[model samples]
Target chain A: MLITRVKKKDAILSLCKGKTLLIACFGCKEVHFEEKEYQALKEDLKTSNLNISGEIQLDYLCNDDYTNKRFELHKKEIDEAETIIIFSCGVGVQTFAGLIPGKTVLSGCDTYVLPGFSGFTPSSHDCEQCGECMLGFTVGICPVTACSKGLLNGQCGGAKKGKCEVSKNKDCGWERIYNRMTVLKKDDLTLKKMIRVRNYNK
Target chain B: MHFTELTKMGKFVITSELGPPKGFHIEKALHEAELVWPHVHAINVTDNQSSVMRLSGLAMCKVLKDKNIEPVFQVTCRDRNRLALQSDILSAALFGIDNLLLLTGDHTTLGDHKDAKPVFDLDSVSLAYMVKHLEEGKDLAGNALDGEPPKFCKGAVVSPCAEPLEPQLFKMEKKIKAGIQFFQTQAVYEADKFEKFMKRVKEFGVPVYVGIVVLKSVGMARFMNENVAGINVPDNIIEELKKDKEKTKSGQTGIEISARLIKELKPLCQGVHLMPLGWDDKVPEILKLSGIIAEKG
Candidate 1:
């Protein structure tokens, strides 16, 4: 999932209290880091006694060409700030780090690789990005991400009422996988553990 | 007899699990499988159940096969990549191991090998697809086999009682599309809920074997409730076990409870898969209580 949570808000403010540049990509809407979170962050920064040089909402900071274009447009602000703070996913943060060598860069959010629904909003469903897609066979469920145990073959001994043993808040991923297969009239495809080994690169 | 034959003859299928030992000590597991004979249509030799290192499901399946025991060999995506999986599948078929159960194995974090890199090369769904490809005489890459392709009585898993049930429902449908022949579900304690879920499952008309793990005690049920993912033991069952532990012998109570569950589930599903969870000997007794004959005199 893209930047699910932000960390070290005070640490960010302390470092960029004066003459600091802020670059954010709260895009990707629902799944990625949202703009409302950054808006709240801006409100917090106003009371922190910081000399804000300028803020750049780098559109799709993960893209190199677009980032460069934005960089060219914000050269004056870049020159004025003493430090750079990023509030996008790790990819966007890395892009800025590579773009600005001399400047001290700070990450505003921590990115999680586990997928969330819709690339932008955090939906209950997730994808493991295991390369081989099983949703076609599993009735659109992703066991790699859904099951806490990630059991490829069957349900664990610990599952209770179709909820996962590890976390009560989360539904048992396998339970959902089975029910989905049943509804789709594909339960026969599940008799044998079909796992032939996944090609991670795929 | 093969599970297919048993089900075809209208015999309510009964299957149980045999966990391979942590080391290569296969004697105990082999012995256990033999002892469970006649009662169960086949024995599911687990592949590293609970992510704990054990003899591979295929190796144990071979061991069981040598003894003429039908083994449901388990395969998981947590350890191997595609080539290794394909090679092993062929090997299992060569050894006459026909039954298989695919899984997205538990995360390596839950096992003793937590530090080892986990290889979730495929989820259970993709694995099911791979099996279908093999059955069609072609590899996942579309390469046709030189001779007759291997045949297997494929079994997939389902956890019926999980909440927010839509995703599991969808995945079950996909598995059918992928060509799974049968389904053995996760541990289920509540028959009413399972029946309700089956009401929806009936839409597909698949043979679904309800999973039943013998509950030993209140602590065991509570631990499962607290630690495991994707299964919940209702409080009433827990309360029954608690009373059993506090006031009577838990072993007898567990048998009664599990047998009661099986009896209730008999008419609702195709079969029952009993996972003793190390309580292998109790399986026969549990079966007996549920009116399941252990042997044909």
Candidate 2:
């Protein structure tokens, strides 16, 4: 149901009667532009545009309130929308997919649009939203985002000269940890503080 | 009144940052202010820290000032245009709160409302100049105010050890030219780095207050390193922190490190600006380490 302008012909050709679609714009602001692009998309249907006949609703969430909303609302959106197109980057898109039970298409915002990478699909049911948000405990580096190996409690020892082994430009989590300790003036005490493994299991 | 006089009179130079609550809980924000009134020299109400809207910084500063805590209003240039920015500065002076910390706040992209549109009114340097011009009874466009402008104890921020320290120093020079009386730096973890930064600028003769942010947890320490720009954390220390987890949980490990930094840096600077973050109660412990008692002068 989340068809891009590029796939408009195919989308209209295979339209189902009772299906509902939801276009989500969260975390990124390029949604305005994306919305504009979709307005200009070529339509091959008899109606010329993919019309949802009032059953479809558009719900948008920016970073401000989206990060803290109740999961029930997100669940309702997913259930209502036959197809969802998300314009966001990184874990936000993936997390939204995890919250909703269905397939979703991903698009990057203008600022986040990396060269050659179009979007991503859910590879596996990776995160089990254990009712705990540990972005703080992890020093802002999500194990799901930066760490390719997905080691939770500790970082992989694969950094050379502050770059990650997998992606040379990517900073190894430990390098960030070291820099953070120095700025806080707790260099000597950095090694002493222990953070327990955050359990995000459902 | 001058900040020096307030400090000299044995009046506690108490300061606090008004973190606007997540919701429309003005009473809760006031309650937070009351908790620190007895100990603060001034309550510094921040203007939409990280550029996310919560409460108006000016209104909150006025509210705290009404409650008898001197308000050191913080103004950042991330949102306002110059005209609005200057008008707000004058309005703050008219409202009677004197202390100010001019900051070039977080980028608009970093905040919750990225699409909310950003207006880089002016950088901290120009803001400092604006403050000076108003003090001289002139507007930014050279128009003179109707009456005598108010005097303010204007201050600015700098991270001496930031990756590129020269720009900060250059800005400091501009602030000095713009009539800044004091400076508070980003948190100081490395006394040696601060000492080196101070050594180069001692000739400026401004009373530099080294920012001392007490690390509440190892996680907090690592968060600052990763997210906060212009902050550098050494490697060996992170390795050590990773190895010894048991001793740090009680926070004694952090306290000791803070005490050591304070003890070393106390002699080189005018005074320490202890940023407790949320841990304001431990300030006394830090004061003890710096050998600074409640000044009776």
Candidate 3:
């Protein structure tokens, strides 16, 4: 599988933390990675006092059966694992529950919101799983997600220049939207003209 | 309307989940919810499911109500003290999301933000009681409401096959006393196990909508077997999938098993809750396979 080695350090640190075993199933495809980048990433983890007691394991599942087998082999151990960290792109993370049976499993995509993930902190407000996500329609950025200020309709004047008024490092929600629009070739639609999205469930 | 009314009519009550995003855009959250409108009987917007960040469940439920779908605004005490908890419940009613699901959410440490503090003011059972009190024109402190209290068809959760069925049964009894009119359980895998579990609790006379999580692949089946609590996947079924691993026919198998379970459990429960797990489009097929129609009523 071609594995891309960007942020290889984080991957290495993740494998080394708070758990006995770290199993990486890259799924059916190869993630592209430059060999040099992979080694350096590995070295960073080693320097950070990662115990490399043969606890870290990586696997490539080219076929579905192997995927099933890998889980079955570690099912018991995984269930008993203090913590199971899954790093798959697809919904495979949701399915992992059946194999190990009993352990806390957290999706990696969600992990990026942690305090350590640079400046991404969860907003003080809670998300009521309202069955709607209004990001794409609102200039390709979800006010609830990308915007730290939580202004449903527009940028919180607090977001000065391009930085969040809440934090200097975080990109203001509007700036992020602007950047996304530029990338998607839809920058012509500015936040000023953005209309309030009506209740979707209604 | 009381859940029994829908049950007596033999309606196929569909429920869907709205997973809140990890941060602050209410507009995006509402728009995403708009996708399943008019399809589900009630949309369950989770309250900090797994303790991850998202838009407020009450806010989302309010948004869902604006869309005219009955919102099951789930409330968990994992992040709030009783004072804030009671306030949010009132806020939910004020916002017009009538239904509420009480939960002791997953620990904060388990979520994306580990540094976040957790506030477990009360477990789900207590929350259920508080809801009942509010419905009875009384506050949590036993004070009377100024006007006629809001009536809620309160619901709580039950896992039929948890190792010690007695604890779950015990909790259910407490919930029943607390005025919980309906129940939706965790995912159901073993039909016979669930049947046996149901026998013990059916006497409560509350209608339970069996949770049928749609399995997309064997990988998913394996994952569920490995991680989720109070759930078990039969080895025979797993082995069967392995034998036909190359066929890529698990989706069909999933539908068949779900349909079979529904057919078997149909007589035992008031309804079935299809947790399509993002495969919402396939729910119709599974329902059809189980001889369930939308009723168009």
Positional deviation of B27 in candidate 2, in angstroms? Answer: 4.0
| Candidate 1 Cα misplacement greater than 4 A, ranges | A1-58, A61-202, B246-250, B294-297
For model 1, report the TM-score of its A chain: 0.53
For the record, the alpha-carbon RMSD of candidate 3 to the native fold, in angstroms, is 21.0
lDDT of each: 0.71, 0.57, 0.58
> C-alpha displacement of A52 in model 3, angstroms?
62
DockQ of 2: 0.01
lDDT score at residue A169, model 1, on the 0-100 scale: 72
**Which ten contiguous residues of candidate 3 chain A have the minimum total lDDT?**
A108-117
On lDDT, who's better, 1 or 2? 1
Estimate, for each residue in B1-297, the C-alpha lDDT of model 1 and write its tens digit.
Answer: 446656766778889999999888777777778778768878998887777887788888888888888889888877887678888998998998878887767767678887877776666777778888898899988999879998887778877876656556656776776777789998888888899999998988788999998887777888877665446788888777776464425478788889999999999998999998877888888899899753321
lDDT of 1 by residue, A1-202 (tens): 4434555456466444348788888556533565677788777776777667788886667666778788999999987786677776655665565566545566666455554453542233344444343433333445556766455554543455665655557776667656644543543433343443444443
How does candidate 3 score on lDDT? 0.58
Choose the strongest candidate by DockQ. Answer: 1
| TM-scores of chain A in all candidate models | 0.53, 0.33, 0.35
Q: How do the predictions measure up, each by TM-score?
A: 0.66, 0.56, 0.56
